[model samples]
Target: MNTQSLTKKWSKTICLAFLYSLSIFSNCYSKGNRIQSSDLKDSLISLLKKSGNDTLMIDSVYAHIRINRRRLGEEYKNTLLEYIDYTTKIQYSRGAMRMYDRLGLNERYDERYDSAVYYHLKSLELALELKDSFQMAYNYNNIGQAYRLQDINNLAIKNFHKALELQEANGNDKGASFTQNTLGAVYVVQKEYDQAMHYFRESQKIAVRRKDQRTQSYNLGAIGEVFLLRDQPDSAIVYFNTAKDIKQQMGDKKGLAVSKHLVGQAYFKKGNYVEAQKFLNEALVIHQKYNNERYIALCFDYLGKVKLKQNQFSEAGAYLLKAKEIASNIHSYENLISINNSLKEYYQEMDKWPMAMLAIQQNQQINDSLFSLKKTREMQALEIEYETEKQEQQIKLLSAENEIKEQRLKIGIAIITLLVLTIAFGIFIQKEKQKRFVLERDKVKQQLLRSQMNPHFLFNALGSIQSYMYQNDVKTAARYMGNFASLTRSILNNSAVEQVSLEEEISTLTNYLELEKMRLQSNFQYSIKVPEEMDIEFITVPPMLIQPFVENAIKHGIKNYTSGGKVELTFEETSDLIHVIIEDNGEGIDTTRGKMVSSHKSMATSIFKQRMKIIRDKFPNVPEPVIADLSDVNRKGTRIDLYLPILELTSTSNA
Candidate 1:
């Protein structure tokens, strides 16, 4: 299926889950057990307190919250926030993970897939730290669902497989079945019906063996969808009816509604307009009761088609118009396209050529928008994958270095032990060897720092210049080339030195930022401020130490904005340190981070951190850089304060 169609289907799938949760709540509360509205807040607070320091209690509380979420509505969010805060305060990692997962689910319902993924990843990290395989599998499934909603099928499949592996390993058959069903759904969207059926059947077998009615109902509906996709309407109806029966037995009103809709669709395909309309209308009532706009629109479209087939032209037009209005209000392009296509048919049958033409035009516009959205998501996914891989490679490199260091340390200890026994005989020789080893290590460290100015930047800058040249923008290309050349020269000149004058560092940063601004079509503004009392020429700092943060602020933060992007660099001298602060008025770090698929530890940032480690080792009195999210301070950006020892350059050549 195309992205727009898949998106519409995904929305309904999410709504189904929402409704299922509601049903769970209803089942729990039906026997005069419902919490009164006035006691709801106090009840939740009591649950939180009772959950203190107890994982099982926390789990029970989370279950209650999940089931009651719909009834709690907007209040559910505040309750979750309070629960998260309490868990965090008590250092309850498991509780915090559960709450984060719930929060992510809430975000997903709001169609904020990026934010949902972020919270899921946070929960995943905690799961990893706690070595909780069940939570890990659950989080992986959640992340897959988020990616699936975005139409990022490859990533969604990857995460689903990860979840499936862990679930099976942990002997969580029910969890495994759930993940299998999710994987099948993704394959269905990809039009791999055969593969989808295989997964659906596997899930169904597991669900039947486990006596998991909920899972069985889900798998049955999925199997029906596969038949529907293959144009086997009779086969689809059989499965849909079975699913509907199971849902009714389980008192799953939401699942029953979904199955009814699918069954109605199959009936329509079989040309049983009267039967299709009956089921579709029934599903429509449930959807309207739940305020599920996507399903409401879907039912309207289906009902219109049934009416059209029955030759009820006026009724068909009315239903189609209703669907169109809902689709427009919700910005559901797929539904709008379907409604318009139905409108076109209605107009053509009525001999209204102008109305049919207008419908076709509107349909084409929606298709174009969907195509553009697909391209944008593809590009973002590619960028995220590339960055994640790069960071993984850097991490592997660091791990290898650490292993080598450990081996070296062991060897040194052994050598020292041996030498101690022969100290009188080899003291002078040992001292000379130790001195040489220190010198070589320091030399290697300096070389590593020099190599840290990644070649990727130079290549990308050159590529941009080439792009501008090819566009025949001679003046703009020339200016970009000049800045690139100047930045390149400054980097090469400073790479050999331990430090550079503050003035030289700032100048290089200025050149680099200017080129980036031009490359980004002047989307951002920047400033460098040095205290009047401080001598920029005399003070020296580690070469390229501050550039990474500045680069991050621009690329990840400001790049999201079309205009009003601002970055400020300020230098202040304390008695023992030079404070260099880089701040940006852009989307805060959290928003920028949500766009990333994985938390890629940046190579530049890693190198800077290593450099800081070296400084802390060599000059014990110097403080390290303090990176802060300005949002924590009630501001609107990121701030990095680098505290450097006020080292003066010996000469201009050294700088």
Candidate 2:
């Protein structure tokens, strides 16, 4: 939303497009002259004037009225919507106009342009229907403010003129003067300094006469703006200071801050470097305290100018970039364009050719887009007017028939399509469920097989140790046999369930690796290292998770190495996730055969996928494990990295 839009929104009530409201229009509902009574109406209407009944209440009330009144037909709905439409016209309900005007004003200040327009336009419709001059003026003013924020100054001017007419009609000379001051603001944006001052001065006179301190401050600040634009720093300072004093006297902190900031700007405009910094820094704090990003960006922009003048290129660039980014985010075209143009000049002065040219290009593009949107909006507005007139004619002839025909056609097609889609979707879901059932049954059977095979493998290893002992070669096979016992117990313990602690899983790997090392005779050395800080016991990873990867590296990679062959397993935690890297310094990979051997591609990758699929069935939200090789760089090695999020499920929860 534009500042102009905000201004229009508030101004609508003040200018009398909307009136200060007091009444809650009761809803009357009927079907064929038999009426419907609702119980919620009295309780809701009693809240109408309550302090906090803002936009939400307003919308709720509108909905309630529409529903309880059963105002569905064109005539009944139009009666209610007619009240809505009048806010945009010349008439208004006196109290209703004021409510909309205040709403518009608040929304404008809060940067809620769309909301402001909605309320102001609603006020406008009511004002028009009631022929209430006060409210009509308010709505016009608010609408104009909205147009102003939109950068549609022509429409803003037109609506402002309409507001002025209504203000005069209502004998609100003071209000008329206020609208004129805003008109001056529009001119200031247009760079028509002289005309801006003329309207501003006229507004100031009325404020001074009426003893309206707030308006007086606004007028003073506005005049200061015109002087600043004209490069008359001294005059701008005088007006800004005057505005500050009045705003302070009125206890308007926001107004005071705005005026003081402008005074700082005037000093910057005058090229008094010392004076400029002094005021601008103060202005920056004030704006920050107020949380006003728009004015804050403005202050920074001026500060950047000062920095550029001092040849503080780095500082200047920082301030400019900050201002440019904020202005772009807020959609403040006027400020953005000005800052960008200034930055182009500064960058060029510093011989930063690329940045300077880019700034120039962006500035042009922004303005072009703004202009194009303005023209498109105008075309649409014209089309709407034409359609509205056509619609009125359409209402008198075949309107009921047309509506019934369109509604029935749409309803019947929608029902049939929805039914067909529902049936198809049901079929798809049922088929998926059946497939999952079959897969689950197969998975349970396989789980039993893997569990049984691990114990049998442990028995074979143990029997080998016993044979060695019988031959009186105890020392030779003692370690392998002990490892086999530990491995068997761990496998039997965890194999009955789906998951085990990372500590248990790693221990299983250690036992298996010990047995492998005894058999392989250190042809390729291997090591396991896990960071102490990693919560191994807390991580409930799958059982036998690391077994297959070890099998792959040793059988495939180390088998091809002649010398200096090694495999290193490391587990660490980073960024709240567990990271595991399995690497080997061996003949990394082979492509000699017509196809990849089982050692490299089959057991680890395919079985790992099955395990992952089962894990996903239980933990569907967790991401799949990452698998990648870090071998190419060394060429003498292969490295595989696995990433798993730090899912610390308790042993009990793992079930």
Name the runs in model 2 displaced over 4 angstroms. Answer: 1-42, 45-130, 378-655
The lDDT for every candidate, in the order shown, is: 0.72, 0.61
Over 1-655, each residue of candidate 1 has an lDDT whose tens digit, in order, gives: 8766754554454344334334534543455545453355556667468556866446545544653565566688788888888888998888888788878878887889888887877777676666666677777788788788888888888778877877676666656777888889889988999989998999988878866666788888899989987889999999999999988865567778999999999999888988999999999988888898998999999999988888999999999999999999999987888889999999999999999999999988888988998899888778755654574354332222343455567779999988776676576577576334221000001111334446777677767767765675555665565455434433432343576556656666766677777777778878888866455645667767777778888877676788789899998866436788899987566534332111345788777778788887755657656656688878888777777865533321100
Give the winner by lDDT: 1
Model 2 Cα lDDT, one tens digit per residue, 1-655: 7766654544443223112111111121122323223223333343332314244334333433332333233233333443344322423245345556555655675677667766776666554555455565667677778767766676677778877766655556656777888888888877888888888888877667755566677788888887787789999999899889876655556677787668877887787887878777877887898789999888888888889888887898899899988898899888998899879978898889999999889989988998899798777556543553463354332222343455567779999998997787987677575334221000001111143344445566656665665565545554454344334333322333555456655655665665665566556666788865344645555555556667677777688655456778898754334567887766565433422234445544576677767756644533554333345464565666665544434211000
Top TM-score prediction, candidate number: 1
Clashing pairs in 1: none
TM-score of each: 0.49, 0.44
**Model 1: residues >4 Å from true position, as ranges?**
1-103, 285-292, 387-655
Clash tally for model 2: 49
